[model samples]
Structures are given as structure tokens and as C-alpha cells.
Target: MSQQRIETIQKWLKDQNAEFAFIQSKANLFYLTGFRCEPHERLISLFVFQDKEPFLVCPNMEKPLISQAGWAYPIIGYSDHENPWELINKYLSTYSFEQNIAAIEKEALSVARHEQLQNLFPTFTFVNCEQGIMEMRLIKNEDEIAILREAAKLADFGVEVGINAVKKGRTEMEILALIEYELKKKGIAEMSFGTLVLSGENTANPHGHPNTKQIKEGDFVLFDLGVVVEGYCSDITRTIILGQPTEQQEQIYSTVLKAQEETLHICREGTILGDLDRKARSIISNAGYGEYFPHRIGHGLGSEVHELPSLNETNNDRLQVGMTFTIEPGIYLPGVGGVRIEDDVLITKQGHECLTKFPKELQIIHS
Candidate 1:
């Protein structure tokens, strides 16, 4: 049961010598409890005690929705006109447990909220619970992996839609809209992140927003997007040529594909996480494009779009079975264009399996 996830939090609090936990992060709240919502500045939190049953605290209007989502526990709702913290103090009084010593997710709780909690219990001591919860979310379970697999397929579908929409004079936003419109037609609730469509020289800005930049004949059009399904997520990036590829464009695309593939080949259980980035960095460096590759190779993904076990050169952690992440490598030449090939994958006992199976053989969209 998902309730056991709260039990795990209880055990963690005891280990940390804390008797209570105040969870404020929506991601952690959804991971422990099956319900997810964006409170949007209003107070929404979960209160847990080591020896008592936990209760969910949310806005009064969301009570029915949360119950329908299957949270079979005590829930306290407060209207906009009421002080939620005061009500929280009243609920703690019922448990007969001292709330003086506690652990809280300092990462998610705001300074104003922390001050309010302090005003309620001036003598309380708070410890950090972020690492413990992140450790629990690091390795995904079977059910989560199943949903991610399904989400990955939809991400591939989005890429196909984007590829089909690529044509001379088509703006990046138009392609972006067509991809998302097609996805929504197929029942995808939302994208894991903002759908990225960068054309021509715009692709050189790896993190650039999709604007009205129009693609042209022989321009390199890049689509980096993802979809969220069942609270899990999938991310994939594919760059296509809009007509006959120039010799320079072909060389750059081939270099990025090789770097990404070389990294993917070593994505197996027990491999050092840092080694994966080094392998890709080495290949790109040898090709004289080292400076063009700026960001880390990839990051962990699960119920949240980004989680722990980040893939970079500084981390010495070894890959473990059941861990999932992305292997994306690219080179961006200033004033020209960029090429990035990314895929979501899971490390297995034997090897690795690609969650996104879209072909990466230099797709060229005819003008």
C-alpha cells in the first residue's frame, strides 16, 4: 500500500531522532501519498508523527478531490479565511505527542511558513528530511517503471508528430503546437516539461524558448520534448534536417549521435555514473567540439521530472539496477546550429533497455 511510504517516513524520523515531519514539497507529498495537486501559494502540506497516523492538510475546496484520489487517512481542510497553521496545532494536540523535536523538508517550506511554524512552537527543533526522502525516490519500483515505459511511447509519438510538421517556413511555435495538439488529442494530460522546438541558428541555444523563429530549407530543426502520464514522465530529444543536409551539418549530427551512442553502450549496472559523462565528453573533445558541449550528460527521472542520482563528472556513484535516467549528448556551434540526441533508459541486471525507441539515424524532413 502507498501508506507504507508514510511508514517509511516515520522510521526515517525515528532514525534521525525526530518525532514529527512536515512535508511541503508537492513531489514528496505525491510520492508518499497518491494524490497530487499544485496549491499555487496556498498552504498544502502533510503532517506525520512517528507513533501516530499521518494526516493530510490541504485547501478546503480540494478535500473531495483528494478523497477521490484514494487517500484513506485523516485529512484536515482549511478555508482561505482561516489560519491553517493554527488548525494544524489543534490537530497535533489530539495525537498527545510532543511536537518539540521534528524533521521537516526545509527545501520546500518557505521562510514565511517556517516563521509561522516557529511562532506556533517556539522551542521546536527542526532537522532536514530531504536526503532521506530523495534516497527513497532514487531507485524506482516496478510499477513506476511500467508507467514510465508507457509515457516514453507517447514521447516518441510527440517526436513523430513534430517531425511530420517540419517544413520550410514553419515557425518553431507552429511545430510545437502541432506536436502538443496531437498529443492532447491522444489523451496526454501535459508535457513533462515545456515542449522545445528550436530551428536553424536558434537550436544553438540549448535552453532557448520556442519563439517565432522560422525554419528554412537545409536548416537543422531540433525537437526536445516529453510527456507526463500517470504522474510518471518521459523525455526525448531528436534533431532533424529540413532538407538536403550540408556536409558540415551531417558531420556535426554524426558526431553528436556517436557521442550519445557511446555513452548509451556503457549504461549498465555497476558502471560509475561519472564514467558515462567522461566517455561522451572524451569523444566530443577529440572531435574538437568539447567547448560546444556545455551541460551535464543527463539526470535522474521518475515521478518527478528530475530526481537524485544526477549523471555528471563530479559524482562518483555507480549505476544500480532499477535506476533510470537520460543519456543525451550534443554540440552547439555558435551562429550555426546544434544537434542533441537523447533517450530515456533503465539500467538492468544484464544491461540497459531504451524507454524511448525512436530511430536516431539522422532523420531528414523534406522541404
Candidate 2:
């Protein structure tokens, strides 16, 4: 377990007037316990108390792996035949004999689990720990940023592979496969999300899926992909043209690129998150493509692809050093190709670091 993070949660519990809480989300479980796992249908949880050794509750099959992952605490494991919730309640009773207010990651805990928890403790006052955890994860520590930096390098390389795979008749799925195959050869087991290779009119959709469409001259090919390194994730999107562009195509690409570049220039500490979104939006709006840009500026990223502090027009949260997020601006016209330039960024003491350094300048792949 990370002693510092454990203490942070302990203090948060004390502040919330919560006797104890359940950290159920896998991301948070790894953050506090230094162990990451997907419970899938099985149960994997952590019980943090105000003044006691936090206990781990997981499937019996993962007991040894949990210990190997450096969780030095009491563990409650259940076999497939056992009722996990009943076992959890029995152990929780030993920790908190009688309590009314129970703190939990309300967002992560399902309604079914909440019902089960209420069943165990009839008189329960559920306290939401989601805010506390979200606030805590807002800032990235040096170690986390370090891993993120490396992850960003991999994301950039993935974009490069995508660009190189462009050919006269390569299918979108073929390009996607090539990117992943190359990344896997270099030891990337999983992408932060599904590898995306959108082309032609499909690029008009912000979250378009890769398909079997063959490349054609003058088509726009978009590569939106990321990879997980250690526990951190990196996301990037770069749109390129298959051949020389028309006047309108060049204008749209340059406008989107300018919006991204200008916004990134002011990404220093102290900028309001909302203001950043507006700055990018205004640039697109002034260019008469406001309606073409549908999504917000960007979203927070770290252990998960999307997290807290979404960059929208109303959130006034101030960016601080050690925070990491993406600044992606795009313009999509229905029935026409689109352009989106995304970069993973880290707020620094003085300015910011652009982790995904893949060139934003439009690349034209000759037919």
C-alpha cells in the first residue's frame, strides 16, 4: 500500500465524520493499495477505517496475488460457493460494531451493493466519499506523471505507426491492426481504449469506430488511440489527408490546428478550466465552424482514460501544477471530412508539458 495515499484516505474519513469506508473502484483500489485487479463478477474491495489496519476483501483465488502485490494487511477471501456479501458484513461488523453513517464511493458502489449493505446494517447513513476521492486524484504526483510521460511517448509512437500504415487501399481495420501489432511487439498489452482508425465521411463522427472501408484519394484518415504503460494512460488523435487537400479542406485543418495550438499556449497554471474551453470554442466559432465542433475541449486522464474536471464552459476549476489532461479541438462537418488534433498535457510549475509530441501539422499521404 502507498503509505501516503492510505493516510490521505484515513484523514478524509476523519474529516467526513465517517468511521470507515469502502474503496470499491478498481482505479482507487490500485491507487491506495498499490495493487490493481479487475474483480469482473467477483468481489475485490478495501475497507479503510479511521483508526485500524485496512483489510482487503477479494476472491479466494486472488489471495496470493494480493499478497504478492504488497498488501500487508488482513484479507477476507471467499470461495466461489460462499456468499461474499455475507462474509463482508461479518468481517465489517468486527471493525464497526455499531455505526449509523457509512462512508463509501457512492459513484462506484452499485444500487444492488448499496441495498446489500443496507441489509447488513439496517440503520445506515450513507456518506458519499466520491468527492473526496475525486479531489485527491485531481493532482498527479511526480511518480504518476513520470509514468504518464512514458505512456505519452507510446501514444505518439502509435500515431506515427498509423500514419505510416496509410496506403492506396488499406482498410481502416488493417491500419488499426498494424498499430496494435507494432505496439504489442514493443510490449504494450492493452490500449487505453479501442484503437480507432476512422476515414473519409466517418471522421465526421467524433467517436467514430474503425471499419472495413478502404482508403481513397483525398480522404481524411483519423487516428485516435492510446496505450497503457504501467498504470497510467495516454490518449491522442491526429487527422491526416490521404492526398493533397482542397482549399476548403486546408482551411478547416488549419483552423482546427490553430485553435489547438493557441489553447495549448495558455495552458499554464492559474487558467480557469472553463476559460480554456471558451477560448478554443471562440476560435472555432469566429471562423464560422462553431456548430461543427460538438464536444467540449477535453477531459481529465490518468489511471483511467476519462476522469474528473471536465473542460467545459461552466466549470471554473483552476488548473494547478501536477495536473494532467488533454487539449483536443476539432471541427466536423456532416458529409465532409473532419480534423481533430489532441495532445496529452501535464501542468508544470512554470508552464505545461505536451506529452504527445506527434506533429499537428497536416500530413498528406500520397495515393
Candidate 3:
């Protein structure tokens, strides 16, 4: 377990005048306790007190796994037949704290679960703790950066496999399957999100799904995928062309490449996060494809693929040393195709490092 991270949360709880924090999200639980579990439809939470030792509650069957995961704290495991909340209340009875205030992740807790928590401690006032957690997670440590670097390399390998699988008459699903098959062979058990491999006009949809649409000559294929490595995630997007591209396609591809590369160049410790989005937007707008470019430049990348410090034109958060995110620019024209070039980026004191090192140059796949 990361005593340091747990202490950080405890500090936040103390500062907020909260007696404790109920962390329910799996990502946040893993972040604080160094134990990761899927606990599907089950209760798994971490209760951290401001001045007392914290304990974890999870399904009884997973108790051994939690110990194996290096959690040296008290664990309150409950069987499937018991109400976990009752167990939690029984456990909390052992410790005495101000039953007046508590911190909870407002974004993650469901309304039903919120009611349960309320029923358990009707006198406790719950305040939002998600922002504090997000702020703490914004800056990447040396170890996180190192793991992200490895994850990014695996992401690059995913793109390479997708590129090699691209051929004439191949369906989008066919290529998608091949890429995942290769990644499985490489020991990747999970992807950051649903793997995206869109070909031809389907690429115009930013979040399109892979299907039976077959690739043909003069089609643009976009590979947007990521992999999980040691609990960290790496996201990368690269669009390539099959056969010779028309002048319009070339223009679209080059504009996206320029916008993405130029944005990456300005990443540093003091850079404004939103300006990166505006910089890329301005380029795409100046190139007469502003309407074609939708969505934010990128989002935060870490243990969870989409997290804090959203990179958009409105966010005013400043980039800091050890911050990591993605810089992607794209142009989608309906009925034609789309082009997106993305890279995982890290902000350092000197400058920035692009983690995904795959080529940004427009790759033309002849035949």
C-alpha cells in the first residue's frame, strides 16, 4: 500500500474538517491502496480516517487477493449474503470520530448507494472529495511516468500491429481482431478502452465502432487504441491511408499532423492547458476545417484512460512538471474520411516528451 498517498488523502480530510473519506471508485481505491480489483456488482471501498488508521471493505472471497496485493491494513470482508453497509457500520462502531462530517466521491457514487450511505450515517454531512483526489492525481510521479512510458510503448506496438493488418478487402473487425490478438500474445490483458479501428467514411465518426465494412483502395483507416501496463494506461491515435490519397485527403491529413505536432512543441511546465487546445483549434480553423474538427484536443491519461485536467479551450489549469496527457488533432469530413494524429505527452521542467513514438508522417499504404 502507498502510505504516502493514503496520508495525502488523510491530510485532505483533516483540512476539510471531515472525520473520514469513503473512497468507492476502483481507480481511486487502487490509487490509494495499491490494490486493484474489478469487484463487479460487489462492495469494495476504502474508508480512511483523518486521525486514525484506515481500513478496507471488500467481498469476503477477495480477502486473500487483497493481502496478496500488499495491503497491510485492516480489512473488513463481507460475505454475499450480508449487507456490506451493516458490516461497515459495525466496523465503524469500533472507532470514534466526529460523526458530523465525511468526504465522499460525488461523481462515482450512485444515487442508490448514496441513500445506503445516508441510511448508515444519517447525521454525517458528506462533502465532495473527488476534486481533491483529481488534484492529487494530476501530477505524475517518477514511478508513474516510468510505467506510463512502458504502457506507451505497448500502445505503439498496438498501432504497428493495426497498420500491418491493414490490407485491401479486409473488414474493420478483421483488423481489430488481429490487433487485439497480437496484443494478447504480447501479454496485454486489458485495453484502456474499447479498441477503435475505423475505415473509410466510418472514420468521420469520432467514436465509431469496428464492423464488417471492408477496406478498399483510397480509404483512410484510423487506429485509436491503448493498453494497460502495471495499472497505468497509454492512449494513442494514428490515421493511415490505403493506396494513393486524393489531394483533399492529403490536405486533411497534413493539417491534423501539423496541428498535433505544433501543440506538442509548446508543452512545458508553465504552459496553459487550454492554450494547447486553442493552438490546435486555431490551426485547424485557419486551414478552413474548423467545423470538421470536433471534440477537445485531448483528455488526461493515467491509471484511468480519461481522468483529470481535461485539455479543452475552456480549462484554465496550467501544465506542471510531471503532468502527462494526450495532444491529438483531427479533421472529419462526412462522406470522405477523417485524420487524427495523437501522442501521449509528458510535461517536464525542460520541455515535453512524446511517449508514443510512432511516426506522425502520413503513411501511405500502397495496394
lDDT of each: 0.89, 0.89, 0.91
Q: Per-residue lDDT of 246-309 in model 3, one digit per residue for the tens? A: 9999999999988988898889888888899999999999999999999999999898999987
Clashing pairs in 3: none
Which RMSD values do the candidates have, in order?
1.3, 1.2, 1.0
Deviation in Å, model 3, residue 363 alpha carbon:
0.7
Clashing pairs in 2: none
Q: lDDT by residue for model 1 over 145-226, one digit each (tens)?
A: 9999999999999999999988888899998999999999999877889999998888898888999978889888899999
Off by over 4 Å in 1: 94-99
Worst 10 residues of 2 by lDDT: 92-101
Candidate scoring better on TM-score of 1 and 3: 3
Pairs clashing within candidate 1:
none
